[model samples]
Structure formats: C-alpha cells, structure tokens
Target: GLGDHPTVLYLGKLSRLEGSELLKGIIEEVLESVPNAMFLIVGDGPARESVERFVEQQGLSERVVFTGWVPHSRVADYIIAADICLLPRRHTSFSPYTSPENILKAGEYMALGKPVVAPKMGGFADAEFPVIPAEPEEMAQAVVEFLRNPRQVPEFQRPTWEVSHARLQRVYSAIGAVSR
Candidate 1:
C-alpha cells in the first residue's frame, strides 16, 4: 500500500555512472526536511551495494526502499505509485558535452503527469521540462517544496513510436538530399 506518505521514485540502474553517491546525499538532505518521505529505488546494478551501505550507515533503511530490479512491464506500476520522480545524475567526464539520447524514462514520467526532479547536466540541461539542480541541498529543497505544495502537472507532448520514426525518416531524407 502506498499510504499517505509522499514517495520519491528513482527508476534506473544503480551504478556509479548513474551517480548513486549523489543520490544518497540528496536523500539525506530530503530526510532533514521530510523525514517521513519514502524513497523507492527500482533498479539494480554494481553500485547497489554502495547505495545500500550508505542507507545502512545513515540509518535510512526504513525510509529507503530498494526494489532491486523490476521488469519493464512493471515499471509503470512503480511510476504511478510515486508522487515525484528523481533523476539525480552527477556531472561526469562526458556529461558536459553529451546529453542522454534516450529520454524514454523522463518522457514516461512526464506522460504520467508526475513531477521529475533531475540534475541540470548533459541532455537534462536541454530538457523541455523543468529540472532541478544536482546539488543535494537544492534538490532536497525542491522535493520538500513539492511535497508541501503539489504543483500542476505540465502538459506533455510525448512522441509516439510512429511520430519518432517519421521524424527520423525526415532527418535521414534531408541528410541524403544534402549529400547529393
């Protein structure tokens, strides 16, 4: 049961590259303001142990729920269960120059009309939707504020597979024309 407590959902791999350390810090900060808030991490990877250790060290085992890894089919259920979605990726060597080519996760959250708090890095910086800073203090503040006063879900225009395929075809045709 989701109950009445606000839930913060992070649906991605638990790896160093995914910024697990930064996530721990953000959770700590969020607990300061909203101790009852629950964190739902729904993925697993090499960094899972480290994140789990941090939770144990901080005595946050009760607040943080590690779902390990769920199947793609069940992902929507978790997303729907969350009040806020978090994407706390830290800046890495290639982050400044590169953005995530795959916006599927973010898009899914937006499609569900959920508020997503992500770091302003890489592709996230260019995201059409609003994103919060990567800093723990700032991210935590954003989460706390949202829990206190829920905001209106933005109108999202998620592209379907057919729409994306058509767009790609157009781009390829344009490139072919230019090459000729």
Candidate 2:
C-alpha cells in the first residue's frame, strides 16, 4: 500500500538520456522539502542497474521504488497512483531539434489530472503544459511547490488520437499546397 506517502512517478525507460543521474540529485533536494516523498520508477532499461547502484550509494533505496518492467496495460495504474509525474530529460545536442517519442506520456499524465514537472527542452519547450527547468534545484522547487498547492497546477485538455490525426492531415495538406 502506498499509504499517505507523496509519490513522484517516472513512467519511461531508465536510460542515461532519461536523466537518471539528475533524478538522483533532484531526489536528494526533494527530500529536504518532502522528507517522506517516494519516487516510483516504473520502467526498466539498460541503465536500471546503474540507477539502482546510484540510489543505494545515495542511501535512497527506501525512498525510491523501482518497479523494473511493467506490462503496458498496467501503466495507468501506476500513473493513477502518483501525486505527480516527472520528466527530467537533460538537455543535450539532440534535444534542440529531436522530439522524444515519449512526449505523449506527458499528455497521458495530464489526462489523468496529474501535474507534470518536466524540463523545458525539446518538445517540452514547445508544450502547451507548464514546464520547469531541467536543473535539479528547479525540479526540486517545482515538486515542492506542486505538493504545497496541487490545485494550482494548470488544467491540461489532452487531445484525442483522432484530433491529432486530423491535425496531421491538415499539416500535410498545407505542405502539399506549398510544394506545388
């Protein structure tokens, strides 16, 4: 049982680009403000072992819950259980132009009425939702602030797949018109 502990969730692959290192730092900072905070990492990848080691090294084993690999069907359960969703991708050379495929994950979290704390990079920078910085201190502050007033988090109206498909069609139509 999660009990009354405030849970911060990350529901994507545990890779280096996912900012596992920064997450550790943010966890330490968040603990200062939220002593009983729990981080629910709900995916597994090549970087899982290293992240686990880092958690242990930082003496954060008890606070961070690593769920390894969960079935896709069960992802929503974890999201529903979270108080906040985290997207801590660190900015890099590829971040400026490359949009992560996982941008949809932010929409999912928002659809569930969960506030997301993501770095302002790549797709996040262009996102309609609110975003914090990728810096550890800023992430920690955002998390603490959200916890203090969860209701203040902005409302996000997630577009349906059909709406997205129609928008793509419109874009293609305009591109064809220009290329003629």
RMSD of 2: 4.8
What lDDT tens digits, residue by residue, belong to model 2 across residues 69-139? Answer: 99989988998889888887766886653245556777777777677887766656555444444454488
TM-score of 2: 0.77
TM-score of candidate 1 to 2 decimals: 0.78
Candidate 1 regions exceeding 4 Å error are 97-102, 126-130, 133-137, 155-180
TM-score, each model? 0.78, 0.77
Clashing residue pairs found in predicted model 1: 99-123
Model 2: how far is 11 from its true place, Å?
A: 1.3
lDDT of 1 at 177: 52
Model 1 C-alpha lDDT per residue in residues 102-132, reported as the tens digit of each score = 2667778877767788776656665644444
- How far does residue 10 in candidate 1 sit from its true spot (Å)? 1.0
**Runs off by more than 4 Å, candidate 2:** 126-137, 152-180
